[model samples]
Target: MLDALGWGAVAAASLLVGAVLALLRTWRAGLIGGVLAFGAGALISSVSFELAQEGLRLGGPLPVAIGIAVGALAFFFANRAVDRIGGRKGGGAGGLPLAVGALLDGIPEQAVLGIGLASGEGVSVALLVAIFVSNLPESIGSASDMRANGKGRGVVLGLWAAVAVVCALATLGGYALASVAGGQVRAGIDAFAAGALLVMLIDSMVPEAHDKAGNRAGLVTVIGFAVAAALSNLT
Candidate 1:
């Protein structure tokens, strides 16, 4: 209801602000890296607690294990596509593919957050904050890639708006369903989100860090996970 709308607005606004900040020439790279780190933390926290616990609650041990495996596979293929496109020879037009994929990925994620937030105010707020914060890197990265591809500002904004609409619809639907079915249903949705996020973290985020920072990147990656885990426990 109103709560869901507020959370959605918060998520979208945070992402938009992050995108603007990320496009600034002087601070873009640093901000992107920092946001990526936060994204890592978010994926780790969501997977470890929300998703895993939800699986166990709804479908016992087997479903949880299966969900993890399936999630890993999903992440693997999605990144593979991104890598393939990214590796193509000069002027590969990164924006379209990324925008499309992001829209697809974002739908379920928003839904998970919407449902999770419905459970308890504190839990939902914390989850929403993590998701909102994590999305900054992605929004910024999208804007930068579009700019590099020579897309006009209007095009970039249009693409962003389109994806945002998809997310809003998906989240609204997920929230409605979760609200009807209550706890067990919410857990299932959380598991799906957790698994998907985990896949994205391992396949994309870690590799990007390694490419950027070389050997020492692993240290940063670990630090990111630790910070997120600690914060999740506090919640």
Candidate 2:
């Protein structure tokens, strides 16, 4: 449990790191977009190579399919609702949606991390690096947008710090679940996370990257994918 909590905190620390970077400097749109694109690609690879593959191996197809469908729909509707509730306005503007989306993305990933820890197969370096790398651009972009919209540094930092804590708790929850749950349940959780992540990338990250980075975003995305794949293979 302690090990799981520590690893979870390590993964979640990127959120604070990214927030600090955003608050400390003014990042160019192109740079931010490029980073977002890269992160998206890495996350895609993580979902495919790590989450989905393990889910298939452990749970078979049906549970994985059901989990994916449910997860995707849940995130889609919830994200829309957040948008409808004025998540895109005022000083907080982009911060609200971004924070919610990040939470949606983070919880499942960290949960799976905890599961891995409890499984005794040890940690997957590929997954850890992917989660950490992907989280960075998300926080940076969100923080930058919030600052641009006149949100105070304290508010932005506080939001990310809170998110990190929640994510750590989520990892601990996954660790706890692992002791009582069977293979299918774990597989379902992994698939569910993959589904949410896929929707998030398509709905926000990819489009945002393209809008800001133009065609160059495509190349960076591919590069990120390649790097992540290499890591997955090597690790």
Q: Please give the lDDT score for candidate 1.
A: 0.60
**Residues 1-235, model 2: lDDT tens digits:** 9999999999999999999999999989899899889988888888888779988998899878988897788779877876776544532346455566678778877888888789896887766777777788889888988888787999999999999999988899989988886879878887887888888888878888898899999999999888887887774
Q: Which ranges in model 2 have alpha carbons more than 4 Å from their true place? A: 87-95
TM-score, per-candidate, Cα-based: 0.74, 0.93
TM-score of 1: 0.74
- For 48-129, candidate 1 gives per-residue lDDT tens digits of 7656875687667665566556655665666567667757845554444434434544666677666655655433455556
Which numbered prediction scores highest in TM-score against the true structure?
Answer: 2
What shift in Å separates residue 154 of candidate 2 from its native position after superposition? 1.3
For model 2, give the 10-residue run with minimal summed lDDT.
87-96
Q: What Cα-based lDDT does every candidate model obtain?
A: 0.60, 0.84
